[model samples]
Target: MPIDPERARLLFQVISSCYERRSLILTTNIEFSKWGTILGDEKLAAATIDRIVHHGRLVEFGGESKRMGDSLMLGRQ
Candidate 1:
C-alpha cells in the first residue's frame, strides 16, 4: 500500500474534511516513518504525518503474519 507523499497528504486532507463534516476511520499496514519511506518525499510525508497525528487518537500494535508457515491454525480461518 505504498503511496506517494502528496497522495498521502491529500488523503489525510480528505479524511480531515470528512472528520469535520462526518465520521471517518483509517487503518494502516505500517508505521508513520515507514509510510514516509514508502512515500519517497520528505516534506509532504512530514506534513502528512503531522496531519495524521494532530487531534487524533492512536493505538499502535503489531500482529504476526498468519499467511506464513505458522503452526497455529488461527481457529481454522
Candidate 2:
C-alpha cells in the first residue's frame, strides 16, 4: 500500500524538530531494513532513518509473547 504523503511530510517535520532536543522512543515490529517497504518511499525512509539514528541507541529484545504463554499455561492448569 502507498503511504500518505501528507502524513509522511508531517511525520518527518516532527522528527526533524526533535533532533537533539529530546529523546524519541518508538516500538515497532517492522525492522529498519524493511522501512522503505512500509514507508513506500526510499528517500523518505532513508531520511527518516538518518535523522533518528544519528545519535540514537538501538536496543533489541527477542522472545515469545509473554501474554500468549501465560494464557496457554493457564488454560492447561
Candidate 3:
C-alpha cells in the first residue's frame, strides 16, 4: 500500500525534526531500496533512509515470522 502524500510529508518532517536529536527505532519488512515505492516518493524515501541509517544500527531477522506461527496456532485452536 502506498502512503498518502500528506502523511509522507509529515513523516519526513518528523524525521527531520528528530534527526540526531532523538533516537528512532523503526521496524520494517521492506528493504531500504523499496522504501520509495512504499513512501510514494523517491526523494522522501531517500531522505528518510539517509537520516535513519546515518546514526542507526540495523538488526535483521532471517526466519519464519513469529506472528505467522502464532496465527497458525490460533487457527488450529
Best by TM-score: 3
Ranking by TM-score: 3, 2, 1
Q: List the residue pairs that clash in candidate 2.
A: none
Write one digit per residue (lDDT tens) for candidate 3, span 15-68.
889999998888888999999999999999999999999988999998977787
Q: Which ten residues in a row have the lowest lDDT in candidate 3?
A: 68-77
lDDT of 1 by residue, 1-77 (tens): 67765686677678657654665566877777776677777666676667567757787765776664454555444
Of 2 and 3, the candidate ahead on TM-score is 3
Minimum summed lDDT over a 10-residue window in model 2 is located at: 68-77
All candidates: TM-score: 0.56, 0.79, 0.85
Count the clashes in each prediction.
0, 0, 0
User: How accurate locally, in lDDT, is each candidate?
Assistant: 0.67, 0.81, 0.90
Error of 3 at 2 (Å): 0.6
Top candidate (lDDT): 3
lDDT of 3 at 57: 97
Instruction: Name the candidate, 1 or 2, with the larger TM-score value.
Output: 2
> What value of lDDT does candidate 1 attain over all alpha carbons?
0.67
